[model samples]
Target chain A: MKKETLILVTNDDGITAPGIRNLIEAVRPLGKVVVVAPDSPQSGKGHAITLGSPLRLNQVDIFEGIEAWTCSGTPVDCVKLARDKILGRRPDICVSGINHGANHSINIIYSGTMSAAMEAAIEGIPSVGFSFLNYAYDADFTVPRQVAQEVTKKMLETALPPHSLFNVNIPDVPLENYKGIRVARQANAKWKEEFDERRDPHGKKYYWLTGEFSNQDFGNDTDVWALENGYTSLVPVQFDLTDYRLKEKLEKEWQFQ
Target chain B: MKKETLILVTNDDGITAPGIRNLIEAVRPLGKVVVVAPDSPQSGKGHAITLGSPLRLNQVDIFEGIEAWTCSGTPVDCVKLARDKILGRRPDICVSGINHGANHSINIIYSGTMSAAMEAAIEGIPSVGFSFLNYAYDADFTVPRQVAQEVTKKMLETALPPHSLFNVNIPDVPLENYKGIRVARQANAKWKEEFDERRDPHGKKYYWLTGEFSNQDFGNDTDVWALENGYTSLVPVQFDLTDYRLKEKLEKEWQFQ
Candidate 1:
């Protein structure tokens, strides 16, 4: 008799979202599933960790048969607390978010969903973050779930490089329309930010952060190109932020005493 | 008459923190200093932005003659708000911190100080984040200021590559003990995290995030090595998180249909 695999699941869209629920459902048959996620929506929280206050974790009956916990912290906090407090050890692999929105390119920099996966990678766990291009509350996670399962199975069967994780984004298409998966590079895409200014009832000036997607990278091998062409994009993201090419250029040209 | 160079400054320690105040004073002579920062401390907030709620900006007289505005958001929010609202136009150079603590190596991923600068880099503004090895409320900023002055002058005189910024960390040593400046790489270091799990008065378990700096990289050109040798470390950081080497490996080996 062989022991069952342990699969840890988490998301940034709070414990009540359909995305994580669907994720648990998809991965449950493959392993003993455990979920630890944020209690409230933590979109765009990035790689934030709670430092200003103590964190409280509560056992919740959200996912009927699954052992789930709600953390009163960011997505990264949930991963850290899950590793240090709940699990007491690292799992076989960690998976985060069948997220309701895209986690491609520059968006990953500000994404709590991918941040959880990055945290898992930093802790030496093979990690993958799943996201759909749709931003609606009831966005379909069906295609994303199937893709996640395939990706996760591959991750478990094979070993990834040390300190590396996957940023997987599924286009908002039906299963039949899915054009398969492509391992692509991060697109040079960004949000052209705009703030909607308005006066409060009490005459205070306030702003709402809004933006539009601007993709200038026309490279056929980039994530944006793949996703736009109806394929799911899988970018192997790393924690090292060093620009080696620029570093070399600076060392040669911009020298200082 | 030459136009006064507009310099945008911010930090994670809040608008009223001594670290940001020292930053303003140091950069004031080089430009028409504008300090748009968080109203309260936002340490370890990473690249977080407030999307669920509205943001308010208030003009403050905290820096005396220097122009400053307090934002009800994270450090990254301050930079975004400053760009969208206050600055209205991109400044010649964006500088964050004189941070009270070190943001070298992997710490930059969780640093509100460096995130603010990264936000600027994403927006095509040449940026730099300065951090001190000391993490005291009243850590001496004298040597940090001198280093910052030299760095900012070079930035103003040189043109950095697009989407690239500098992460500068100064050692907490006297000027006489300094081993000079080092154009270093980010050390492959991490925090050995320990969760101090304790029970509250109500008998509920909570966690306080604590960690020890684990420097495993023996490279003499790393930021950790430079700081340990009493040298200010300057590492050029970039926003693109793609591991090109890993991407090439995956492309050749892991061909998914």
Candidate 2:
């Protein structure tokens, strides 16, 4: 008999979030599932790892019949500990999130959800990060759950290139209005940040980060365009950040003395 | 008369670290330098931003005749806060680090030093993140300072492409043995992680993250090769994580339902 597929599930929204629970329900039938995630919310943590302190990992009885562990660290740290301590062997595939908010465009760099999946991809595990457009606690997971099932099935059957992962974002629409997935590129976009400056109770000034995401690229083949057009966007992501086109130009023309 | 160039400086190392002090010194002659950095070390913070808490920024009289501010946040947060609140304008260039350890290859993904520079690049500023192989607090800044001066001058003189940044790593060799800088790609490398599991006084188990740097790629044009061969490596990095080649193949071949 063929060995059972091992699936590692995690998220940046903490272990108890409805999103991860919905994700678990989506993929549980396809493989033997194990979960290791952060104990608390770690939304915009990016690729951060805990370096200055020891991490606490305890097995929790959260999901019925599923081995779940909670970690006191960043989303990336949970992946590291999961691989080094909990799993002790590489899983067939790793899936992170069903995150509470969208992680499209430039949000990937600030997203703990995508970073956890990216970390797994870096470790040679085929990975995918899922996000829904809704940010509410009671956001509908029906469409996201279906997307997760379809994407997860495809991933297990397909052979992805090494060190690559998928960033999948679902539009906030009813099942009837949801368009199929689109393969797209990351859009040229950014957050227009503003600091909401205010005084503390002690009269000391402090600032809260706030921003408006602005998509500057009008290309229809971009992730932002796809998401806005009521489709789920699936962008193939890579970890090698080298700008080869510019690297060649510099190598040939520029001089460093 | 030409308007003076404005340079924003920051690092993952705390505001008072010798690394940032040396960096400020290196670029002090190039332009009007403004320093905004973290109040505590945030070495592996990656691209994290402050979301859950308010940020504290305090003006400090650390460097004589130079204006500097200390922020109670990550390195990337300093860059954002610098642009929106402190500087209230875009700087000509943003430079981060003279970091006390190597941030070459896979280290870039976990580095607060590079993330700060990347944050600036995403905002249309030409930027460079510098790291030396030495991890000692008292590491010699002789060669690094000179390198910073040369690179900063070159960046100001050249018209770089938009939304790109440089990751420059120097070898720990003596100045006499230091080879000139070489433009290279990020090497395929990862950490071989090991968890140091131990029991606390309460008999509860905790784990400390420890890892050994492992380089698997043997490319002569990679950053790892340059650093090992006693040369400074300059890798131009971009924020778009999209894998275009894979996307094209998937779009043409894969069936997503």
Which of the numbered candidates is closest to the native, going by highest lDDT?
Answer: 2
Top of the candidates by DockQ: 2
lDDT of 2 at B219: 98
The sequence of per-residue lDDT tens digits that candidate 1 reaches over residues A38-110 is 9999999999999979999999997788899999999999998888878866787899998989999899999
Alpha-carbon shift of residue B108 in model 2 (angstroms): 0.6
Tell how far residue B240 is off in model 1, in angstroms.
Answer: 1.0
Q: In terms of docking quality, how is candidate 2 classified?
A: high
Backbone clash pairs in model 2 (N, Cα, C under 3 Å; residues 3+ apart or in different chains), count = 0
TM-score of chain B of each: 0.97, 0.99
* Model 1: lDDT of residue A106: 91
What is the Cα-based TM-score of model 1? Answer: 0.97
If scored against the real structure, what TM-score would every candidate get? 0.97, 0.99
